[model samples]
Target: MKIKLRHLAGKVFLSLILISGLSTPISAQNLISNGDFETWEGISTDTGLDKGIPAGWTSQTGDGNLTLYRTGTPHKGNYSVFARNTSGNVSRMFTPTLQPLSAGKMYKLTFYTRGKGTLANITLTENGEKLNGAVATSPSDKNIFASPSMLNKEYNNGKEWEKQEYTFTIQTDGIYKLIFWPKSTAGTDGETSDYFLLDDIELVEFVDETICTLSEIIVKGSTLKEFDPGILTYNITLAKGAAIPKVTATPADTKASVKITAATKIDGTEPERTTTINVTAADGISTREYKIIFEESNEILREGFASEDRPEKFTYPNKTNWIIDANAAQNNGVFFGNNSIRPKGSDFTDDYFTIDNCTSAGILSFYLKNRGDNANAILTVSYQKTSDSNNWIELKTIPDSEIGTSYEKISLPINSGEPVNIKFHIQKTAGLIGYNIDDISLTPFIATKQENEKTGKDIVFANGNTIHLQTSIPTNYTLYNINGQICTTGNVSGEYTLSVDTAGMYIISLQNANGKSVHKIIIP
Candidate 1:
């Protein structure tokens, strides 16, 4: 049932837009040649200064050295890299050939650092013969940092010089060797006297408009919290024949796609209604959008997800072997990096961590800890009985019985009313070992406010294309659809019309014996 239908052909509406195209490729250059350090060489003519070779670059060990070049402290012209190791060194730097990338594409690097002492870390490798560069710090599977604790600090003790950048993508194509390495944060004693500087260093080829989406959009118990993912517009009032809400969007690059196309009915003459959701990335055409209006209002939505950094939103590009672990956690603190990636280095991955939105959400708790031998770990959920109808049905899995080895607590169920996306997956091969997850949560599905005196508290929303219901008492009213059948019934009190003959989703219940109330509608 899809045709022309622009602006409202008969009427029915919904909202959701998680697009992130990032199209901006008019040109490209910057490969890194001497990057700012302004190029320098020589021993300042026999050690008068200039001791850290910075003219193009290379490093297996310090050849033609001059003290690691600082030239009094230049961030732009003179020179940078102030390094100085001794007690078992490894000072690195490479960048010369490059120019191959292009498979999947994306790039971007930029640089600048500070940390004159303590933990001055940095390190990023390539030269792919197999990628994972054997691991340097964190984030992997293909290009996510890979190690050194997921690298990202620009240091701030030498006072200033921060400026970082990341972007990444370009999985594999060829011609490698990039490595920058900077080190120092481990156990100390790289023979003390360690310093840090580095300079501008750009790198190019980008187009990652970001769009991590689903900032905060609750459903079922309602609560839009002003919706503003950078002014994509989100409104949300509902009441007058209410029922036209289903705005689930979860795309932070899972190949990304939501292309906006949901509008669940309801239109008395339109007080307000809008729809839009066109998230396109993964190289289809680079897009972005998210509208969702729907006004009217009488009130009836409780809202969900409490908040407390909300588990740092789960981690890395938002859920992906969800790293963080901080050595280990069950309650000890840092959680994530699960599916068993233990006592070897810190964490490992196979992938799968999703956790998006979740409206009526019925339970999917967390905290597990299997070690291997296939202890089992997989939980899926994206269901949708009916709210705006995306028909997403996976319902349940939570198998492997419940996994074990250490941590516990694992809840599972998840019925779903609207925004719901939950994944866990865990598989191991090459030797085995996988499991970890903590505090994860979602228990919503309780909306029960209650109020009915006719022109005031809760239930009202009456207009046409039929969706009229008042309520003072009289009770006895039922209208269910979305598969439960029973389209209509009688005996409501102050008002009633609800004929939603076609389009989707509806629920209207009234009670008499002193209490009972419910209203959910949509009929564009």
Candidate 2:
């Protein structure tokens, strides 16, 4: 009586065997030795072979009607078995006897193949008797198996290499051999130029089927949190106005499949969005799902210098003299993103960039680093009111003593109630090395409402060229002219008055242990 067995296609079949749980514990070990076809014996020369055969494999060439040789063209290794038919007679290549397979235990045989014309027929045999059904039963000397081929034409004929796999279970326990027929009567009639190539063969026993996980998840235009197969949830913060990201998810197992679902709308429509990725194991039953949450950031302006083009909100008067170095990270110990800006030309010259029309009170922050050791290297941060664009007021200055080779964050408070323009100036006194800047960002200032309430009772006003202040407790004060230059700073108790030399709009900052408050005064 014929043994009953099931044959399934490719990797999907492997997954089914694993999920079916018809065998003992699963083993990743490949039962076929020299499966990669890397080692060969019986070679006559470097370029050609005399009856060359792969180790652990034997061949029947029908008395040279079919030629079997080692070819450099391979799917993965240095060589693969190449078979060419000179005559229509059948020729075969047989795998060494495999370890005994138990009845009721599922097994999978996989290999990569590509060629022209009729390729080959695959069969499982025991003691030279067909185990899986056979294709040919005539020509007593040539009829080694039954009739009709197992591999179909759709899978065997193609210019590009294709992976093929077969899964089955035996009815009895015994050693078995896998056979490849280059010209089986069951296959299409062979031609003189018909050829076939084979490599990377594998045989394994299936055990379990619950592998439902993603090996990788990629979101275009954004970086996802570090991926962990065990972690199914992730969060990403996108810049405002950024396009919805495209996601690609890859399953951990080749036999498994993945599907990704992304947000249908743009960012401004919703504050937050969710993208889901689903993975299904080869068994078509075991499954897993992952989620990525995207939210918009609350920054008015942020520039990392990740590209060559200057930011739209910024103006560089000497554009050609500036350099946006792409290899900042390798050149300097610290850098933000991929690039950083620096003055490229003559030393001791001023290189500056200006941000136009900043309308809100905010905190301006950026990274600064000096590449040279010159003591005269300096950076000046300044701002100008929109009404008086010609007059710039100095906010802060960073000298070489404070600047280091590594990047450091510099933050300044903008207390202006009117629109202003911000500027950054860098100067290097005596060397080619200059200052590098990156990661500039402006965030809206959050006022201390409670502190403002406590200081509300304090009266501050200006008349003529003098400013007057009355406070319940001792307070420290700093005065800045519209040009952003410091006018005066002092500590006072009860009442205080300060005189200024010029007439313009001035900013007075009063501070005590409770908090700080800023006031605008017009000096005539």
Candidate 3:
């Protein structure tokens, strides 16, 4: 009964080791003597094991001519084995029992290996979770033995003992299994004439900790302008402390500001405070500063409405880049218009478009239909900055023959503040040319480099000043004052010449059927 009891305890211990080893290969180690490293150490060749080290070890697979020698190796306890692959397409593996690891503790591991393989990957896992895995090099493995220091460096070949080490902290606590596989990759199924050597392995825990730190934040924009009701848009950097629990943005110095109205939102978050607090320094130079609070709410909507019109636009997603006012007659859901509002010879004279300014530098885009006929006839487009009828400027004179007779898109850049107007004058000579204009939207062009910028009121170009205005179709010459009253009109073709003779700040407006644009010019 005493002998039986001892045998039972030994069997139970072996069973526990096997059960744990089967859980995950990465976390399990074959701790038994010679359980891995197929080195036939003390075994003799008469037993069918062909390869034996010069010192005493033996190998049973792949060219049994290789041997395990007592070369005073480190991890292997006093000796190791070396093999050379001259015919290529060769490999070897060893099973070892590893120790357990603790959670949240960093560790360092070291081993020795050498070879010339086109592919190499090392994997290490703790418990059931993977710790680290990475591909070493690409198009590699020229000389497997070049230096003596590479044996322990993890990669590269060497002439002497090499030590490869890795350090990492475990996020989970449990026993881990490690695997080292190196192979010479071929296109389909080629050959490998490389060599690999293995030696002692060591694992140790690390004590130093250096993490949980944050990086500096930055904020910027291209241009800042006031638009529709003084609402500003800025691309702010959501900093580190921003995610802290229960933090909120106050308008005053304590935690909030006072300039924000109750209906206002910061960074698109609905904050408990309603003021334009200096939580952010609003710095316009270099790197601006922003206060991050730990709040359950956000200020800015990730996506929202358009605050201005983009006229320097042509292409778009889904439907064409044309949109119309829902309440407007005709194309209520946004329609397409050819080049000229009216074809060349049709006497259908009503062709016009409008662009509502949302920011200082606005964009207007539309499509033109080339009826496949027309040479020199032109279109007359005009514009005025304010709907009050003052500071009007003739933009361009587009020929009827030039009307959408070809497959193409057109964009016009408006130079003005928010709330400006646009107009188009149609003209043609020979064939019929028309156009389709829609998707007229206005939004602030928030600069990805500048801080939050606000749009300002419409610019006032003084009377008699020369200002450039772009349009979907070109136009003739026209003049207006600050009172929405038409001053002078011209029938010039294609381009407008503005030599107005008045004074004071004013707006030079230009337009086409698609939209309108405005620019501020000073009249001396």
Candidate 4:
């Protein structure tokens, strides 16, 4: 009994430990700002306030007083510290007798003051050096804070609270004293000191919890409309949190889609975290989706591709590829010659044609049909996955010896995502230079085992001439075989596995005489 009790206790302790390890919660960090004056009591040089002045604030000896105003409610209120000069020497200095400030972060300074003072200047100094470049509103009024050289303006009157806002972006990160000095050398004349009413002095950091962030998106479901004879567009929104999150996306299947991904950071923050995914179909249709994630390093956007025109011809620093003549000319030339490259092209063609549905993955098929008497043509095709067009690698070079008789088919396999641009040239290797290109197609090949669903009965076809019918039929429909022959037909509009004993190419057409129309399918 004693041994059993001990064993049970040990098992219970081990279980508790395992549960604690598995249930660890994610750590949370403080989003609110530090260096705020809510907790300043004891006075010190490092502290941002001084109690001797007014609420730990001290203004220069004068008839005017710097007021501390609070906006909004108690715990969630905004405080503004201002200096108002009623009548005295135009010089003013109000220093916080407690709590130091943290540099590098941005701080908002709001204040309002109006007086007959000739000149006014609010100098924010740490130790003895001025932190920010001075900004003077009333320059002519020597009794007010002097504006900076760039902002050469003077205050008009010393009454009424004139609103003004200032943002201080600290360069160096550290703790330092914050002092507000408003001076007017206007001297001790009968003129009263210019009024400088201040308010709403609070320091807080911005938290990015409301910025837009992209979670998950489907391009097919979000298409807006069909234009350009069926050019569909899809625009999907993302989850924009306080700070927009950056994004990087990979398509599940490249054969089904062609897309480009990009991201932008939230406003007033480094390293934009919002991403935009652009998708363009083979029919020259395009759409975009945005995704948001944390920040990271990436290339800055210099320019956007022109989608209106097909890019068949490309030049260096220019990422355009041409598969056929576009009749478009480059700088100071009409013919295609390689020069001026992103990687700096030299002695290259100036004219080129861009292939529609071109991709950098798998294999791309190029059909070059012999039109002219050119037996062996010299054509050079270069491709790269980078913006620098010069970085492109030569894919295929058809010398005078490799051109075969009759129509020839060329296949080039590529693995790239950077160089979306490609350049091509057809030259006389030995004999001729004319060849017509037709049926240009880009096919992305994927090699992966597809798992079969529901294992039970098995049906096999001896001949390779298997007819796979994929249709969207509504009700009862008839499926006809080759030579106007009707073998087996069904009404279902789903995956129908049929067995055909014959070994030949068959054309299967589905027609509902009383319904919409006829659908055709070819089996080889």
Candidate with top lDDT is: 2
Instruction: Name the better of 1 and 2 by TM-score.
Output: 2
TM-score of each: 0.24, 0.42, 0.27, 0.28
Candidate 4 lDDT over residue span 328-401, tens digit each: 22111111111111111223333344332233343343445443454344667766664554576777776546
Candidate 2: residue pairs that collide: 18-208, 134-147, 135-146, 135-147, 135-148, 136-146, 136-147, 393-483
- The TM-score that candidate 2 achieves is 0.42
Q: Could you arrange the candidates by TM-score from highest to lowest?
A: 2, 4, 3, 1
Better of 3 and 4 by TM-score: 4
lDDT of 3 by residue, 1-524 (tens): 00001124112100001011111123234232342244454534432323344322123223212223222333345445444323333232323334666666555555565433321333343323321112121111211111112111234463444455544555555665443333332221222212345665545563322211112211111111211112223223221122211122322212212222232333345342222212222221212123322122111101010112222222122122223222122221222111112232444334444433222333334444444453344444454566445765655555545555443434444444444555644444333334433333332222211121123222223234564332224444334444334566543334344666667544344444423333434567
In model 4, which runs have C-alpha deviations exceeding 4 angstroms?
A: 1-52, 60-90, 96-103, 114-119, 128-162, 184-195, 207-524
After superposing candidate 3 on the true structure, give the runs of residues whose Cα lies further than 4 Å from its correct spot: 1-64, 70-72, 76-79, 82-110, 114-160, 164-197, 200-460, 465-524
The residue-by-residue lDDT of candidate 1 on 127-236, one tens digit each, is 54233223333333332232232233335455467665654555446555455544432222232223466677767776654434545444332334455656676655
Query: Which 10-residue window of candidate 1 scores lowest in summed lDDT?
Result: 10-19
In model 4, what lDDT does residue 451 have?
A: 15
The 0-to-1 C-alpha lDDT of every candidate, in the order given, reads: 0.48, 0.64, 0.34, 0.35
lDDT of 2 by residue, 134-192 (tens): 23223222222222334323234455677766566665777777676665222123431
The root-mean-square deviation over C-alpha atoms between each candidate and the true structure, in angstroms, is 24.0, 19.1, 19.5, 23.4
Sort all candidates by lDDT, best to worst.
Answer: 2, 1, 4, 3
Model 2 is weakest, by summed lDDT over 10 consecutive residues, at 10-19
